[model samples]
Target chain A: MTDALLRIEGVSKRFGGVIASDNISLEIRPGELHAVIGPNGAGKTTLIGQLMGEIGPDSGKVVFEGNDITVLPTWQRGQLGLARSFQITSLFLNFTALDNVALAVQARSGHSFHFWRDARRLPELRVPARDALARVGLAGREDVVVSNMSHGEHRQIEIAMALAMQPRMLLLDEPMAGMGPEESARLVETLRELKQELTILLIEHDMEAVFALADRISVLVYGRVIASGAPEHIRSNAEVRRAYLGDGKKKAAGGHG
Target chain B: MKTIFTVRNVLVFGLLAFLAVIPAYADVTGNTFIMTLFTRIVILAIAAVSLNLIMSYGGMVSFGHAAYLGIGGYAVGILAFEGINSGFVQWPVAMIACGLFALVTGALSLRTRGVYFIMITLAFAQMIYYVGVSLDRYGADDGLTIYKRSNFGSLINLSNKTTFYYVCLVTLFATMYLVWRLVNSRFGMVIQGARSNDRRMRAIGIPTFRYRLVCFVIAGMMCGLAGILLANQADFVSPATMHWTRSGDLIVMAVLGGMGSVIGPVVGAVALLVLEETLPHIIAVVGHFVTGLEMTAAREYWQLVLGPMLLLVVLYARGGIDGLLRGGRRD
Candidate 1:
């Protein structure tokens, strides 16, 4: 547990009548892609939010690198090496892709109070931004404004932003949400390459990517983790099958069998 | 790098050149009124530039920016009334006072978004306005007359009208240059990022509130400089200087010019002020020709013509006049 990069212990959050995160507890070890797979409204995003310090838990703690970060603000969590990408493409729509990644680099570099120097011309920031963009296979599209880019590119930019921070762990909320098959495959490969170096808590609906890339998988259902184990273990678990994957497979079989 | 030969750049530079030569033009034509009008335009352009920093780049729509103008003016007026007429003392005091007020109000106001943010800023400005109204010792509601302009000693002569106009014109250019550096700098990038998406800014590890608050204070102090110039120009300070409507005019100037660029607000200030001054006479002439209405009566409704013009600019030119000059590019 002490070796875990992030620990969510007994985290519970309620929105009036409905519970968003009910007694959710999970751990992400160093250098592992731990994916949280769930159906819509299954508290997966809420769990990610709690880990990223955006939402407060009703009762529990989010321990990051052995520090209790339950009361820390979102930016502090980021400073402590926890970065997140939103489920919805949250970006500076007017700025270029290079500018977006460069901002992430700027956040990690130091205070941004340097008022006179042109930030775009800073090689210290631009170099890393370029490297991150290249890592995401977006080499030549650096100057494209975010709003002008496709939805899939926005998703890639989100990942590139997280990668640019060089965080200890990444909390990705549906990175492949609206991606085409080719884009998703590319992302899966990127995540595979990434998991070899960095810790990732991936909240994704793409079952193929989740099953293929996750070293460990947790099945969240109605605000609770019904199963937590290796991907093969989660795939064969009867409760998880009945709750999520099995139900989907049954519907597919009925429609096409 | 983008070419500097674009239409917007040409217009901006041309306007600067025109401002620089206005005093000579007035001297040649024996038209002192032209100099005075241009001076006011230059001073208000500084205020508009400051407003654009927060409104356009930082995404903070403050409805009480004129409060700083009032504060800055009062700092000068009150100091002069108390017999401290030194420019060195008055200007810094005005800037500091404006910064403090912005810090306090911005701390509270920035917590709210959209309409609430607008209302809180308006409320704070109104509070300052009433305070200005209640300063019974310094001419209260009617306002205080500055008997003498802040003495700059051997640095410059404030008594010379042409000298003062040049002084204001220089300040306007300096302020624009300062804002230009700010928006393109690291600090500016953070502020712009916050404006584009504040939540994403925090998610990426930049504590955005503090950056925004700093930006707000910077804007306040810059506008305060304009206030100092305004008071010196009019030789008067009143509660009306910080009135909410003045704040609205600043917003209009920024929006009308083009909030996207640093010089956009200056253009807006020039366009708005010039239209305000000329619209009545133009309206009177047009009305006389078309409707046979009395020139005086027609002139009273110049705002009717101005309102539709502003609406057209807002609807058709999303970036304002500067945006149009940039060939309709959004940013």
Candidate 2:
């Protein structure tokens, strides 16, 4: 058995004639923050979709925690300790913020077939839901309904929901997609703290956050990983510079790490 | 048990109080017709409450909800035809038959969504409606009349109009309480969350399909009970009870009452049925004065007012009557 917590071996996917994931393969070792960075249309989201079982790879095996999850449904993957945060904030808009997180907590805690007790009145669920919200700096805002929350707050709730599931690994797709600068910084800090306790597959366009938090960075260009190594190696990789940084641009090398 | 002490809560309590005292007022006024009309309203309100469970809360708009009414009614009618008149035997059979139908239809229909879901459910309900029309021994499309109501023995008297009305009212409130408890429960939350965002629910490990199917079946069974009561109240069963227009009426009631709230559809039933009873008369009186037209002609044109009024409500009252009562606030 391999030591990798998640192994993507020779995965390829195509949307008709468009080669979205071209025989790409990567491994995420246990308890390490692995960031996949690419420009627009580098198949970043497609890769996440395949891993989460929303899109099937034409020819590849996705092994997670010693199970081949290539054909498993999205809910099964979630039950196997795999969680995803949508690039666009998706939450129960009509429910309270606490109710949203409580549902996620409810997923992992037990079967949701209990139809008698009020979930809102249950301390077992609401308490950890509150804890999850607090972890994402949404402490006092638990009672605020998501419909009234800001876009940035929705992003935070997305992460909080994943956290509430208590998954062994997280497949975060652009967690900072629409966050303001202040919100982005706060999320980066949250992710940094989160990485201390979990394995993370981060897909982001925020170069500064990538350089700051990623243990190892992989540069994807045109549905292929051209370089995968430490932050310093990727910062100086010749091909990555040409394809991503456009070579002669000043501050071309990302040195935040 | 935590009361919001809002205006909405006050109105809901006030409405309940009015319903509670209706029997006493009807007895004093010797208005048995009013009692009969309100009894029909309470029975329909139960069915609407069941629809609200999945329709509004679960985001499943089944356009053939009246199928359960027919199925339950047929179960009672068919059983009575076969010499089974016990409420115990008839009621459970009705529930199981409706539940089984819901299970099968829901399994297939849940595979589709949006307008397709609406169409598939409508198709299933119509299929049942025609089936009801073809039951030759049960009087087919002409309907069947019962010689006696289900024998409940000494515990309850179904023959007494006031007793039957009270029974319907009590059962209606019980259903409301059950639904209120349910929506606050874990199962209800799962259904509501799936309604809001099914994809996210799966991302967090909720197998939403099974829950949705169970919810569909539960709603069907509840409405099935309403159907049993409806057959007893009418002392008859017919294919007309399950017609497409009746299904549309239920939708209008749920939407008008306020789908998000449990009691909203009940209010909707009261409003729609009450309007149906009184509007034709009101139009006849007003039109005779204004247009100097014959009473029947004026009454026949009442829908012109109703059509515009429903359109206005749909456009302006996004949350329906319950929402309007709460000043457009959603629960």
TM-scores (chain A) of the candidates: 0.96, 0.95
Candidate 1: segments with Cα more than 4 A from true spot: A249-257, B1-3, B291-294
User: Over the stretch B153-265, how does candidate 1's per-residue lDDT look in tens digits?
Assistant: 99998878999998998899899999999999999999999988999999999999999999999999999999999999999999999999999999999999998898899
Question: Which candidate number has the best TM-score?
Answer: 1
lDDT of 1 at A171: 89
- Model 1 chain B weakest 10-residue run by lDDT: B291-300
Query: Scoring each candidate complex against the real one, what DockQ results?
Result: 0.88, 0.86
The sequence of per-residue lDDT tens digits that candidate 2 reaches over residues B1-331 is: 8557877889888988988888899999998889889989999999999999999999999899999888888888888888898888898999999999999999999989999999999999999999989989899989988767877889888889889988999999999999998888999999999999999999999999999999999999999988988998998999999998888999999998888799999989988899888899999898778878777766777778887877888899988888998888776
* Residue runs of model 2 more than 4 Å from their true location after superposition: A247-257, B1-7, B289-296
**Local lDDT at B305 for model 1:** 90
| Residue B122 in candidate 1, Cα distance off native in Å | 0.6
How many clashes (backbone atoms < 3 Å, residues ≥3 apart in a chain or on different chains) does model 2 have? 0
